[model samples]
Target: MTMPAFALDYLPLGAPDFSKIKETDYLPAFEKAIKQNREEVNKIVANKAKPTFENTVLAYEKSGVELDRVSNVFFALVSAHKTPVIAETEKKVMPMLTELQNEISFNKELFKKVKYVYDHQLKKLKGEDKRLTEELYKSFVRSGALLSDEKMERMKQINLRIADLQQEWGTLLPNATNNSVIWVNSKEELAGLSEADIAQCKKDAESRGGYTPYAIVIVNTTQQAILSSLDNRNLRRRVYEASRHRADGTRQFNTFPLVVEIAKLRAEMGELMGYNNYASYSLEKTMAKNSDNVYNFLKQLIAEYTPKAQAETKAIEDYAKKQMGTDFKLQPYDRFYYSAKMKQEMLNISDDEVKPYFNIDSVIVNGVFYAAHRVYGLNFVQRTDIPTYHPDMKVYEVHDKDGKLLALFYSDPYRRPTKRGGAWMSAFAKQSGLRQQLPIIYNVTNYAKAPEGQPTLITWDEVTTLFHEFGHALHGMLSNCKYNTLSGTAVARDFVEMPSQFNETFASIPEIFDHYAKHAVTGEPMPADLKEKMLKSISFQQAYALGENLAATCLDLAWHHLSSKEIPTANEAANFEVEALKKIGLYDEQVPPRYSTSYFNHVWGGGYAAGYYSYLWTDVLACNVAEAFQKFGVLKPETGNAFRQKVLSRGNTKDQMEMFTDFTGMKTPDSSGFLKYRGL
Candidate 1:
């Protein structure tokens, strides 16, 4: 059988021939890759000699190379450029991949060989070798290797069903979001938005065949960014309601039923594994260690956040009442608009004033890349010869200060109908010294594109997001690990966000900020007073930011913490979410969760399931690291190198906390940094 072009290795590591690859190639490529992987595994199982660290552990680690390569490209496209064909391909391919995983996990002979090395030879191994042995053993146990025959069979079925449900939820939620666009017949309804914004809405409507003259597309989050600028109260309500109910059973593409089923199945899997709930099973290897610890940490923060949030809401309400008569009442849609208005009035800063300085290209080159060069001695040279999956993507060759080719970086920085909302960092190939593979890292964002021939200006929040995603890229690009399994951003969910969040601190630093925050038209730096106002207002809306996030995190926990019997029906999903928020003291009508249950793709579809609190958990770690950088001078190369060595490059080879202590000189990460950073 001839290997598909997509499945073959590229001459330059990690660069796929994207121009030749088609949606039709994915299924065949996956089938061949899986077969190749199974054969490699079979070789290890058939070895007659006694298992050793090299033969058993390393062989298993190296076995699925082709499959991983195919999967990396396939899934990246599915998320970043999902057309109808790609979506259909995902529905067919996911089950086959899941079954392959189960086969590897449940192979009694393979497990015996891996266990033999883990039990007898692990003590002799050192550093990454030992860590790999331990991780491999634990992975087998987590995959039901120790279960009875009946339970193992049942686990296989559960895994298959869960995979299907996750794919369904992932597909349904994004379609629902796209379909929920609010089409306004006239520009009068869009009076509050800027001319550029209004133009973009018109363009969106025209792109969708002009169902209406203007269209407001719903983003992935429960709170849409447009809410902050919209003037008409009724339009704001319409947009907010569209976002809030996008994936409810009432919608054409519903995910409520899928959410309930996934939760119940996860609960059953947890029970089979002898855990109280899915959260317990999931958190066992994370830094938080257990659900109780996560709950306690959230509880501590909630006690402080609730009062601050109440005061914040009261202030916004007071402002709203003054603006519109005394009888005016605040609603969820009013929060962003009033918050922005109050900030503009109080601090004399607005997104409109800040956006001109944040032209998308300048932010990428002069801002994000500049900081990388200053701290990490890295440089990016754009490559036009490389083929990309989309025209919006730009490829760059990343070079170290020593002039050696380090990695390939790709950037996709615009919103499209097919692209999902929010931003993320992923790789077509992860760094591995053993495989001699260089990382091919890409960052995908959903910032609205500018009109033809117009310069793209992004919000300050989006600028921070750009920097945040690059932090994850750096983690992958600078990885020094030998094994692919432990390389790059493959750390604990609770710890992985630390790198990304810590990177955000760089976006506001004066040295870097001045370079990138130039007016798109004039190329002039922002005026000193304007810069001061913008910097001063960084902590302006901490209550809403923290409140929405905590509500979502708590909502994630509420679903996963339930036993099988406690799982709600599809009809009760909304009520369950309301009660969950109320129980956690996060039930504010004016400040909903960053994601509601029905449209909470992060929990349901994204791998976050019970792990959404990781953003808060790692924010603490990130702030602590940020404080350390401040102590050492934020742009100091010495501090950056130390972090790259201690954290980013280390990957999962060392203990996560130990890596933190090694760099920060603190045994425990300080929670005070989080409070100080958020201005609570």
Candidate 2:
């Protein structure tokens, strides 16, 4: 019998040949790739020559190309444009991949070769070679390479269990999100929504074959984006309840048991790793070295934000009473509604007024790509020749200043039942100097799709998100590292977000904003008065935003900081979350934590775990760097080149803080810049 030539085996230079891919191809491709990778590993362990950095470490670095190729494309599709076949494929393939990882992590002969290079040949290496050798050694040790055989086997089982649960939760989470959509019986209940929005909801209902005149789909957050404009209190309550209780209801998708089990397993693993708790073990590799530091940081934020949040809540309540009845009590659903009203009353600005100027296409070509060209001298040309995973996905060819090919970028934007919630950047291929590969990166977002023949106008917040995810893409595209493992966005979790957040500063710049913020139909730039009002509205609800974010971080810490004995059962999870919020003095009836535990995918299903604090932690660094860019000249090539050299292109070859100081001439990360920006 002859085997078929797999799409994973052959591809064009820059992009994955998506047209050649089929769901049935994954399992066989994975099997063949794993075998090839294992054979490659065997060569390293069985080499007759002395274990030099070239013979051992570098060989190991480039060994798993085929496996990496399959996993990258598979996972990217599973998140961005999934189907039932893809979901089922993920459920089957994840365990095989996990087992393979365990085999390599526990390969004692391989560990000996890697350690020999570190112990003997490290000083003889130079630059990224030296850094790669050290990172390889540390990676092995950290993956239980030094554990006794008995403990190693146990660790392997634990890792496999973790992988299984993660795969299961990945499927359940999105289903739960879709299942939680609130169906309305009449159009009168959707009074505050625009006609386009109401029509979209009706279309959603027709597609889902559910009750009624409209369907309000819940995004993967505690508060729905539409909650702000929803005039009916009961309907708002329904949407809020559905979002907050996602994956926690009596349906088959409830994640309560999975949450408890995941936390318990993480606790046990931490104990085995000789750490105090999972948080300690997770934080060991982050800039914040311990749970205590995270706690202290959150406490300071609470002290600063609590009073301001109280004042904001009082003002909102007063406005709510005037709008509703005097006896009406402000609820969680009312927060955004009343806050938007308050912002409008105070500044005469609203999302509706600013959205028309932020058509998605203009924001991308004129706004996002324009800013990139100004700062970095990078160019993005659309490519229709390449195939994409979905019809909606757009591919671009990115070129460096001297017209050198940098990367192939794919953009998949819009929401559907099959696609997951939120926006993110991912790579189908990563850059590597040894193999001489350029990056193949993609950005995925869940912006609501407009009706056919209608423009996809976006809010100001979505405009910032466009810039933010592209910031991450820049990190991947600009990376100039030698080894694949240490390339592009591979820095410490706390440090990885800095580049992306810093790029968000461009969203509000006068030149950048004027370039992109044009009316969808008329192509006119936003009016000066509206632009001024929009910019001033940045700090309108700063305290609540910061407080809720801090609360979520604290909640993540509280769950992971517990000992094995303290891992709560499923029933205690909700109460545990409330108590945790209260303990941090961040509990507010109107402002719930940004994500409650049951649906907090960042900590549970996503890789964040105890690292959710990275957003704020990196914000400190982002502000410092952004301030430097402002002083030096935001659009100057010199400033951009300095940042690329000192930070973005360096990967993890240097300490993150040292890289920041080198770029900005700052002695330490200053939160004052972030505080001033937020008006906190």
CA RMSD per model (angstroms): 1.7, 2.2
Q: Residue by residue across 472-497, what tens digits does model 1's lDDT show?
A: 99999999899999999999999999
Predicted structure 1, TM vs. truth: 0.98
lDDT of 2 by residue, 338-405 (tens): 89988999999889889999899899999999999999999999999888878888989999999998
TM-score of each: 0.98, 0.98
Model 1 off-target regions past 4 Å? Answer: 1-11, 249-251
Worst 10 residues of 1 by lDDT: 1-10
lDDT of each: 0.91, 0.86
Best by TM-score: 1
